[model samples]
Target: MIKLLVVDDSPLMRRLLTEIFSAAGDFEVAVARTGAEALDLLTAFAPDVVTLDIHMPGMDGLACLDQIMLIRPCPVVMVSSLTAEGADETLEAMALGAVDFIAKPRGAVSLEIDALAPELVDKVRQAASARISRATRLRERVRARTGGAMARPVPRPRAAQRISVPRGPLPADGLVLVGCSTGGPPALDALLGRLAADFPWPIVVAQHMPASFTGPLARRLDRLCALGVSEVVKATPLHPGQVYIARGDADILITRRAGLLTAIAAPSDPELYWHPSVDRLVSSAMAQVAPESLVGVLMTGMGADGARAMTELRTRGGHTIAESVDTAVVWGMPGALVAADGASVVAPLDRIAGELMALFKA
Candidate 1:
């Protein structure tokens, strides 16, 4: 059985969570109403995973997360609401080492809450298999950035010098396609931040995120990276020096027209689990462009969504890169791609930026 610690201040939430896990038949849950209580149970419970609530009385979820990571360091799935504030806090929690999260239904304990049971159970199972990133790096960075204070909000991403792409023909260098999930946000922030303002090829990213968060993530990336970032709009013409984020609620397709690529955001196939499915994106790119003119990158994520497509791209002479296990927060996605002979190169997190640059130069 997967040992789980459920940390929520609301009694109703705690009960609902326990009932949900109990019905799942594989989880042994121990509930905590506060962060302090959760810490006390850590030694006795020895949970394989934890579901933490963001709003608790004393020592709120973030503070509790910091402490838990400092001490035990296990996979933690954050329980969050669907509001903007909830999304922001959830992103911050992920940066601080939480593995994943599930949005809570509106009512505390109603029919709506019951509807979320399956999703909660599914996410908990995913969390169980997730690899927790090293928190010390993030902790130290936070300390340095905040002058050793731990109470401040996550710092806003620095604004980048925006570059306006001219209305003209696409560059001859080709296109870059990136696919990621789970721990993708920070990884992308780091990878894209390393590019120069004149990055010659158009870049498209398929990141598994909610609709509300995608816009904020794109804006944040635009502020931090040299490339101008925008959420994909249907029929929008793509250009060099710009990074397009696939719409979170839809699958985005790249189409070739007049020597330029245009992004078409349309309703995703309901059967697919991941919105903006990476496989769909890569498959579309392969259809529109010569395989040799593609560069496919598979980063940290939970599943093999893009592995097959990436392999196909590589077989057709496209350059493919996978993030190495040592640096990926979760090695499943990239590892699957690498194992399938999809990647032309495997690089660590810090080196991916340089590797991509070198590939572009070549």
Candidate 2:
């Protein structure tokens, strides 16, 4: 059974969450009314996973999350509202080491909660299996405490050091296609921060998120990355040094507008399980551009959204990179690609940008 701790200030929310998880049969649930209570139970209860609400009374969810990471780094799933502010806070929580988040239903909490039960249970289950690196969390905490002076260098993975991809000059109009879910925000930050502003290819990302969250996510990435980042809300022409984040709740399709490569937001395909579907993105790009001119990257996400399409991309001479299990918070997406024999390179998150730079070298 999975041991889950549900932290929320609302008695209704706590009860609802407890009932939902308890009904799921495999979960042993515990509830806390405030952040302090949650922290108090952290050591004694020793949960495998935690579901945290952002609006707690005293210490608040973010503060509690910090304490949790510092005290005992276990997988955490944030329970967030479906508003703009909630999106920002949830993204911040993810950066601070949350495994995933479930957006709370809007209006009439009691009535809406039942509908959200399945998703909440599933995210919690996924979080229970997520990877949490205690050393990395502690290093981050130490660096923050010392303001970077006492920070220690992290050793690069041996696999990253020995990356041996064929050196070549990619086409002038080449594009990089990235797909991720679950623990994607931080991974994207790490990957995009490594690329220079003069990167040759325009990059597009299809991250599974809600419509309200992707805009804030794009804005956040724009501030952190050297590359210009924006959410594709319309038919935007692709340009080098720009990263286009697919609008959530919809799919971003690659097409040519008057001979210029463009990305347009389209209605979500009902057949696909995840919105901003990565499979659809790669498949659509392949229709307009040669597979060899595209590079597919499958990062830390749950499920096999991009595996088959990326495998086809590889068969037709394209390059594909999968985030290695050692670094991925959830090894589902990239692991799927690796399982299908689709990845041209399977590297840790820290080494992905280096591999991309190597592939695009002139």
Candidate 3:
């Protein structure tokens, strides 16, 4: 069974979450009334995942997350009201290594808390064994923070120094490939929004999200970017001016036949380490796209899925990029790529959009 910890200030909420998660026999739920109490239980219990409330009475969710990273690192899901401030905090939480966020229900039904029981339980079960690494979260907590507008991209100096762009322009046919998870939804939306209607070539992305989430995410990004963004339908023909997201329970793969690139949605077996394994996508990409035709971009999330594949891509003479740490909601994915020297250009989020545009044109 996967052990879970629910941390919230309200006694009722703690109980509510517990009752919801308890229905899943696979999850063993534990409750912490506050961050302080949660920390104590975490050291003792070593739970698999944590669902946190952003606005707690004493320490607040962000402060608690910082402390939790230092004391004990675990997959965290932030639960907050769907207000502007809540949105801002959720983003901040992601930047600090929180895996994902959920908007608290706001209705008479929500007063029962149990009204959200079914969805809450499903999320908890799916998040079982979130692959967060202790060292990564520790690093985020140690970093200093400066306030800024919510939309402004955070700078990552370390990653900038880590990358070395090529001396001249890249190949004209380079296709940009990106992969992300955890806090990728809003970030991906922001990323796709900056592109022009004529982005020159195809943009493909693989995000580790459930089936229910991907379609909504695609629609959201579709509304945000000039480029068409939609959920991947199996055997769909790859096209430019359009982007596709890999649905849950499968890691998307690209196949080439007669010079036609196609998207293949392969069913995921839990036996594999990660559900939407970065290795699956990256390795498949390395094989499908010729060395002269592809550029890989690795972004934020936990685990080392893209690490080896990024190295392989670079070894195959393909250009590669890693999202700088500061801009990442969680630095694991990009951090792994950087550590292995897989990135051709390490850039902040804001610069990545502009850089990608220029790359496709070259």
Candidate 4:
């Protein structure tokens, strides 16, 4: 049976988590009331996975996470409250290497609570089954084996930046806007590594994931990309020379307030399939930046979130690019753009950044 560990300060919460996992029938559960208890438990148990609460007395979740990663490393799923502060701390845990998180319900026995049980169990199972990113683990292992500065790996060709277009030159102020899902990690890394460090415009991205995952995902991208990268905060303005990735599960829309651009995470009624909707951002950005906006590229994703926006932008005199089907993990988004006449250019991932730069020059 798979061994599972749960750490939470509340007795009721610990019991509830145990009961939920018990019904899954594939694992054994162990409980800890604090980080100290959790560490003691860990000394005696090699758990396959852990569910750690974000709030704990004496030793909070993040400190516990750092110790766990540094010592007996295992995949951890953070349990967090619904408040914004909870969201931020949950994000911190992910950046410190926690796998994923679940927001607690208002009432313990509420309908929402019951609904989350299956998802929690499944996440635990998946976390147990999956391997950590090879690149991340490789760096860690290098740091472990030798007390030396580990060199970052050399990236593949222009997978991140190559662009195709009917083109004049690219615009100088057209910062990159990237959208991806599923196989985004490695693909984005490859493409980002090829981008010029001084690419003029600030990059804005919308990737499908939960809010907690974005911060860590951005840090991972920062490690791989030459440009400065960080998770987008609510109302953070677009600035040249920095790349901002939208915090996930929110519809990322760009709005211009008195001539300045802000990345707005707005609530939506599920008109689109992907959280952090590319359509919302692209469509809204057109109005925000207007005629000055030169290019929008739709990368790998499962659905057509960006197609309508691409169409709107193309109709209004902006260039659009899509990733080629051959290299796309799931060509649905880019393919929709290609099929919809939204894309002015379609090429492999390698050429997009250069293509964008060319459009800027024109």
Candidate 5:
């Protein structure tokens, strides 16, 4: 049986969560009414996974999460509200080592919790199997507390960083298409933070996230990395040294507009299981640009969203990089690509940037 600890101040939430997991079977469940109680159970219960609510009267979720990571690191899934404030806190929690987050129902009572049962169960199950690096989480917590002094310094932005280049002649530079889910945000930070300020290529990312979260995620990444990051809301011409994050709840596609390559937000396809579909993004880019001039990167995620398309990309002479199982939190997406013999290079998270740079140079 999978051991699970549900931490939330709301009695209703606790009961609902317990019922949801209990109904799923194979889950030995424990409940804590507060962070203090949760901490106590963290040792006594020794849960394989934790579902922590973000807000409580005292010793709130974030504070409790910090302690959990420092004391006994385990896979944690955050329960967050759908508001913007919730988005920020959830992102911070993910940075502090939470594996994934599920948004709370909008109403106060959240009587509609049954609607979230499947996703909650799946996320918890996935979290149970997720790999947690205690050293990395500790370092991240230290960096966060110390204003990032403990973190490696990213290069300062260049003088002429372009948010969106004018729609004119297309540049000769190729594009990097990145896809990730589950443990993506921190992995993205690690990958994008390593690139030099002058790295040549426009990177477009399709991270599975909700609409409220993606904007905040892009803003957070922009503050951390050298490259300017922005969510694709309109048809913006692609520019080297810029990173485009697909607006969540929708798909971002590459197309030509006025002879210039552009990133545009599109309605999510009903057929794709994951919104901001990676397959759609890569396939769309392939339609617009030569396969050899594109690069497909599939990172830590829970499914094979980009595997097939990236495999085709490799067959067509485009380069593909899969995050190796050693560094991937889940290894679903990248592992799929590797299994299909689609990856031109497979590397750990720390080595991905160097490999990408080498590929571009070659």
Candidate 6:
């Protein structure tokens, strides 16, 4: 059975969460009424996963998350609300090492909490199975933060660096499409950091996130990467040396105008599971660009959103890549691609950027 710790300030919430986990029969639940208490229980409980509340009387979820990472380094799933503030905190929590989040339904009461039992249980299971290296690193960072230990120098902005333009004419239809969910933020951060600022192909990214969170994510990436990164604006022209992130509330479509590709932001299809859906992006790219000119990458996520389209891309001569299972936080998205024989390359997160560059070179 998976061992879970449910931390919240509300006694009712704690009890409800515990009952849900207990009912699943697959989890052994431990309860804490606050972050401080959760920290205290970390040693004795030794939980495989934790469900953390964002707001508590003292030492909120973020603070608790920091402590848990430093002290135990286990999988943490944040319990958040669905409001804009909650979305922002959820993204921040994920960046700091939470594997995922469960958005509390409106009106935080026992009934509402109980209503989400299945989802909460599922997320706990996923968290328990997630790769923990990132969490371990986060723990070390927390230690450094508290101890004033030496840390890596922050990367400087590239404002003064000369931007390299593509040497020759822009490749008629070449494009790089990246899709990710769950552990996407850090994965995107690592991959984008590895690429040169003057990378010569236009790259588009679709990451499952709330609309309120995508802008912040783009800004964060812009600060961490050499390349300019921005949330997609409708009808914006796609250009090399910049990365475009799909707006989380809409699907970003690649459109050709006089042979130049541009992004068109459209309302998300109600039928789709994810806004800014990876499948929608890939399908649109395939329609606009030659198969040989496209490169599709499916990364860590919880579902098979991009697998079928990735397969089609591969069949038509586009290169396809998937994150390797051991390196993925969830492995479901990339695993689906693998199971469908969709990936031309299966690589670890650290190697994906280099692999893409090599493919572009060849």
Please, what's the RMSD in Å of model 3? 8.6
Better of 1 and 2 by TM-score: 2
What candidate 4 gets wrong by more than 4 Å, as runs, is 1-165
lDDT of 5: 0.88
lDDT tens string, model 2, 1-362?
Answer: 99999999888888888989999999999999989999899989999999999987779998999899988999999989888999999988887778799988889989998998887888889889999998766654554444334523554754653333563677777899999998998889778878889998999999999999999999988977789999999999999999999999999999999999999999999999998999999999999999889999999999999999999999898889999998899999999999999998899988899889988664
- Residue pairs in candidate 6 whose N, alpha carbon or C atoms collide under 3 angstroms: none
Worst 10 residues of 3 by lDDT: 143-152
Clashes of each: 0, 0, 1, 23, 0, 0
Tell me the tens digit of each residue's lDDT in model 6 across 217-329. 88877876789999996787889889999998789899888777988888999999877899999999889888778888899988788998989988877778888885689
Better of 1 and 2 by lDDT: 2
Off by over 4 Å in 1: 107-109, 133-171, 257-259
Which candidate has the top score in lDDT? Answer: 2
* Tens-place lDDT digits, model 5, residues 289-330: 898789899999998999999999888878788988877888
Displacement of the residue 207 alpha carbon in candidate 2, Å:
0.7
Candidate 4 vs. true structure, TM-score = 0.58
After TM-score superposition, the amount by which residue 294's alpha carbon in candidate 1 deviates from its true location, in angstroms, is 0.9
Q: Name model 5 segments beyond 4 Å from true.
A: 108-110, 147-149, 153-172
Task: Order the numbered candidates by TM-score, best leading.
Answer: 2, 5, 1, 6, 3, 4
TM-score of each: 0.86, 0.95, 0.63, 0.58, 0.93, 0.85
User: Relative to the unseen true structure, what is the C-alpha lDDT of residue 23 in candidate 3, on a scale of 0 to 100?
Assistant: 70
lDDT of 1 by residue, 220-282 (tens): 778767789999866778888899999887888888777778888879989888878888999
Query: Candidate 3's error at 95, in angstroms?
Result: 12
True-structure lDDT of candidate 3: 0.72
lDDT of each: 0.80, 0.89, 0.72, 0.72, 0.88, 0.81
Candidate that beats the other on lDDT, 1 or 4, i.e. the better one: 1
Cα error, residue 128 of model 4, in Å, equals 19
Q: Model 4, 189-299: lDDT tens per residue?
A: 556656778777888888877776677667766865678888876788778877788887788777776677777777753767677888777877876676446467788
- Which residue runs does candidate 3 get wrong by more than 4 Å? 1-159, 165-168, 269-271
Which portions of model 2 miss their true places by more than 4 Å? 138-155, 161-167
